[model samples]
Target chain A: MSAFYSVLKRELRSYFASPLAYIILVVFQVISARFFFLYLQGFLQFQLDPSYQLQTGDLNLNNLVILPYFGTISIVLLLIVPLITMRLIADEKKNYTAELLFTSPIHIRTIVLGKFAAALILLIMMLLLSSVNVFVLMVHGNPDLGAVLSGYTGLFLLGASFLSIGIFASSLTDNQLIAAVISFGVLLVLWLVGALSDAESSILGYLSVINHYEDFGKGIVDLKDVVYYVSLIFLGLFLTYSALESERWR
Target chain B: MVYVHNLTKRYGNLTAVENLSFQLERGDVLGFLGPNGAGKTTTMRIITGYMPPTKGTVHIEGVDIFDEPLQAKRVIGYLPENPPLYNDMTVMEYLSFVADIKKVGRKEKKSRIFYVMERCGIAEVRRRIIGHLSKGYRQRVGIAQALVNNPSVLILDEPTIGLDPRQIIEIRELIKSLSGDRTVILSTHILPEVTMICSKVIIINHGKIVLEESLQKLSEDMRSAESILLRTRQNGEGVVEKIHALGNVSSVKPGAAGEYIIVPRKGAEVREELSRLAVENDWGLLELRPVTNTLEEVFLKVISSEGN
Candidate 1:
């Protein structure tokens, strides 16, 4: 555990020591804020009926405004989380510092977990910054706090899943650019799987990231959705650990 | 103490190290002399538990590196050919991180880092970013990281490869002082470095140990078969004929400008006889000195023997 913490601390420090964290946070904030404001403009311009919402309908003008805002925020996070994690392992290998970590007494799991935790922390920080959009909604009009909390929870799980894939991709190569491209490509495929196959295809919907996220986005805390995200995260981490173990043999 | 028994590493079909075996007692400074691609680095990596050998085993203090890596690794510190450094980090930060990973106790981490910094002569540059430091300082940081845990065994792969002459001397002194308490394996093809700092030398070629002997003993053995350079005022014909006729002189060849190099039979010292012959022939003896083999010759001899 201490080894894990040590790696986490060093990785986090490394993130802040460069322009990476700041760039990630700034870009996330700009895109998410722009999406939120555009959603607000669309809400006002359409002036749609306030009480004609979907299945979990406690229809209010605020839910109508905030749901699309949170949706856009999730999209923006999906794009930015990979950027932060793609360099985690790939850059370490490129710089040859992976040898230092591998030769240390610490286990490979500890190193992977540490990097995962650091990327998670950075994503959480950016998510927290994006929550200001929620606060702005609260100040202007009444909004459902439960729905807003669920939206953030959904964002966190999505980010975690994206980060896991990014780390796995990073482990596949020593080039950060290639890792980023591959991770983004993987996430895009996962996001689009549902569209390529009908909802009747259970496996396709099961594999789609959007299918799992839809429950949380609707402010529904479905046990199956949570399990799916957790399973994806675990699978990605398992592949990352295997990748590092195989590197020693190479 | 360190023991390697029949260690071999193969990447696909190419064998990096094959049937190599040697022992290192405590306080022994062993030099690993090998040409490029001779598996010096691969052997060190295996012994350090960075990579497991495809065959055989490595034991440090009676603990097998593969079976008990943490225990075996706790006793060994390794500096690879290129120092693994985080360029974004300051020297002090990098050392601290190494201390943490090496599992140094929190209370002693600062003092240990400082001690290693002072020992490697990088204390003054402790706060400088590692990427901005000079090559010598970077090398010192590498050594300092390896020494931070105070392991009983130190494995250095060409620690002086890219340093200037002054830095090389300083690093050699530093490594020399590091001996007597730690079993250090200094790997290099730099012949002079082996003679200066290593007590025992292992010369490897074509993935096998061709020669492993104490530096002093190897030189002493070669000294008995030494050649003598004799410079005389006489022309080439007179010098060669006179030296060749001397007792115990096996062969004599005329060198540049009337000089002659005489090779005596094994265990023979024909210097006095050659001197007397020069006097008898009225050839003025300008210089007569026994040729002692430097480590360079020993290395070349070992490598060439392996080639044959």
Candidate 2:
């Protein structure tokens, strides 16, 4: 347990020691905040226009602003999470620090778990920073608090899944850029796989990472959606562990 | 104590280490000598539990590394060819991190870090970032990190490769001082380092150990008067035949600059007779020296013999 915490602490410290983490946080906040304001503007425009208001009798702030805001930010996270996770294991290999970790009296599972936990914590912090925009709606307007909480939950799961994929990709290569590119490609494919089929029961729809996330946007924390995201996280980390283990044999 | 039995590692069809076996009692410092691509690093990695061999078992302090790597690794410290360092971390932070992973007690961690820093002579730069330190300092930090756990077995691969002459001597002296109770297996391209630090030497060639012997025995065998060099002032016509005719000298080959290489019979002492012969022929004996086989020559000889 101490070994696991040590790795986690070192990884978090490493993230803060570099300029990349701060740059990522600032960039994510700026871009997500911009998208939030755009959604708020659209909601305001709909409230002022009589024809629009007549077509949709009541404009729920949760549906008008928060749902779309979370939706666009999920896409932004898809683009940004790779940057956060690319160097987790890749830099270790590049600098030969992986040797230090592997030779130490710690299990591979412990190292992987520690690194995953650190990245998840950073992702959570990123989400919390982005949520300040949603808090504005809650302050001045009456947005469904339950829906906003569920939306945040869904965003956390989605980001966690993306980060798992990124760490797995990072484990496959020592080059951080290649790790980032591979993870981005994998995340993009999983996000679009659901588009291949209209029926939600289809295997493609079931496999799409983003499809499971829609329930969270609607303020629904479906057990099925949670299970899917959790399973994806497990699969990604399992693959990473297998990759690291096989590296010894090779 | 450490024992490696029939260790073999194959990557696809290429074998990096083949049927290698050796043993070390407590306090033994083994010198691992080999040319490039000789599988020294591969063997070290396996013993340190960094990598699993395709066929073999390594036991450190009676713990089978393959069966329980964590238990085995807890007693081992390794410094790879390239020092594993986090560039952004300060020396103190890096050592603290190592101490944490190695599971040093919370109270002992601080003192252990300070002890290693002091031993490796990096205490003055403990607060400096690892990346900003010089290469010599970085290597010292590497050694310090390896020692933070106070491991029983220390495996160092090319620890002195990139250091200056002074730094190499300092590191060698430090290693020498470190070897009383701790077992050390150090691999190096420098032959003299083996003579200076190792009690036993293992020379590997093509994934196999070609020679393993104690330093005292190896030097003894090397010093047994197999040949001698005789340098005289004149061109020394017929000196080879004359020296060979002296009975104890088996054969003499004339060399450049009026020199003759005399090979003597086993246990022969021909120096006195050679001097007499040179004086009788009025050949001014400029130099007479016994040719001792250096570790370099023995290493090359063993490697070449293994190659054939």
Candidate 3:
């Protein structure tokens, strides 16, 4: 566990030592805050329309505002999380620090887990920052507490799954641009599988990460979706560990 | 307390280290001499447990590197050909990170990092970023990282390969100071480096061990086969003919400008007799000095003959 913490501390320090972390944080804040304001404006405009109000029984602020806000955060993560994770293993190989880590007494799992945790921490921070919208809604109106809690859980799972995939992509190459491209390509395919599939009950939907995230957006927590994301996290980390172990041969 | 037996690493059909085996007792500084692409790095990597060999085993104090890599690695500190340093980190941060991963105790981490930095002569630049530091400082940081853990075995590959002369001397002195209970194995093709600090020398060629001998024994062997130059002012075959006919001289041949290089037979001191003969023949001998073999000659003789 000390070995794991050592790597994690080093990795997090490395992230903040460069300007990448600040740039990522600033960009996430701007995009998520803009989406939050736009969603609230659309919600207020709907309430002002008497025809729409007479047709619908009621308006749930959780569904109208908080739910879509989480949706936008996930999309934003898909685009920028690759940028954060591109340098995880790839930079170590490029800079030759992999030699130092490999020669140490620590296991490869500790190294991978440390990097994964670093990326996850940043993602969590961004998620936490975006949750300011929830505070705003609580001060002004009633939002379902259960739905908000489960929605945050789902977003956390989604972010973790993205990070693992990003880390796996980074392990495949030393070029950060190539790593980013690979992660983006893999993520795009997974996200679009929701539209590419023919039926809701098909395997494509089961495989699409964005499809599993839809339940949490609606404040509905399902066991299958949680299992899917957890399995993906395991699979991605397993592949990364295997890739690092086999790189010594080449 | 290090042993390697028949260690072989093959990348596809090409072999990097082929059946290489050697041993190092505690406090023995071994000079690993080899030409380029001769598998010095590959062998060191295998011994450090950074990578496994294709076949064979390495034992660090009786613990197999492949079977129990963590325990084995804890006792061995390796500095690869290129120092593995993070450019973004300060020297202090990098060393502390290494000390942490090397499992230096919580209380001793600060003192250990400071000690290695001081020992490696990088204390002045502890807060400087590694990327901005010059090559010499970077190399020192690499050595400092290896020393932070206080490992029993040290493997340094070309530790002074690119340093200026003063830096090289400082590093060599540092390495010499490090050779008490800790066994040090450093690789270099430079013969003087081997002669200066190494108690024993292992010359390698074509990914195979060619010669492994103690410095004492090697120096003794160098004294047996000797050559001397005899330059005379009077130019004639008389000088060569008379020197060749002498009993102690093995062979005498004409050299440029009335000079002849005479090879004395093994264990023969023909310098005085040659001088007497030169006076009798009226051959004014200008230069007659023993050309003792340097480490260059010994290294050349070892590699050139064994290359086949």
Work out the TM-score per prediction.
Answer: 0.95, 0.95, 0.96
TM-score of chain A of each: 0.92, 0.97, 0.96
Clashes in candidate 3: how many? 0
Q: Per-residue CA lDDT of candidate 2, range B55-98, in tens?
A: 98899999999899889899998999999999999999999999
Error of 2 at A27 (Å): 0.9
TM-score of chain B of 3: 0.92
TM value for model 2: 0.95
Cα-based lDDT for every prediction: 0.86, 0.92, 0.89
lDDT of 3 at A19: 95
The lDDT leader among the candidates is 2
Name the Cα RMSD for model 2: 2.0
Model 1, B281: alpha-carbon shift in Å? 4.8
Please write out the lDDT profile of model 3 over residues A80-102, one tens digit for every residue: 98998999999999987888899
Each model's Cα RMSD: 2.4, 2.0, 1.9
What does candidate 2's lDDT look like per residue over A1-250, in tens digits? 2999989999999999999899999999998899889999998898788777566534678888888889888999999999999999999999999999999999999999999999999999999999899888778998888888999999999999999999999999999999999999999999999999999899999999998988888878999999999999999999999999998888
Q: Tell me the spans in candidate 3 whose CA falls farther than 4 Å from its real position.
A: A55-58, B234-237, B241-246, B272-285, B301-307
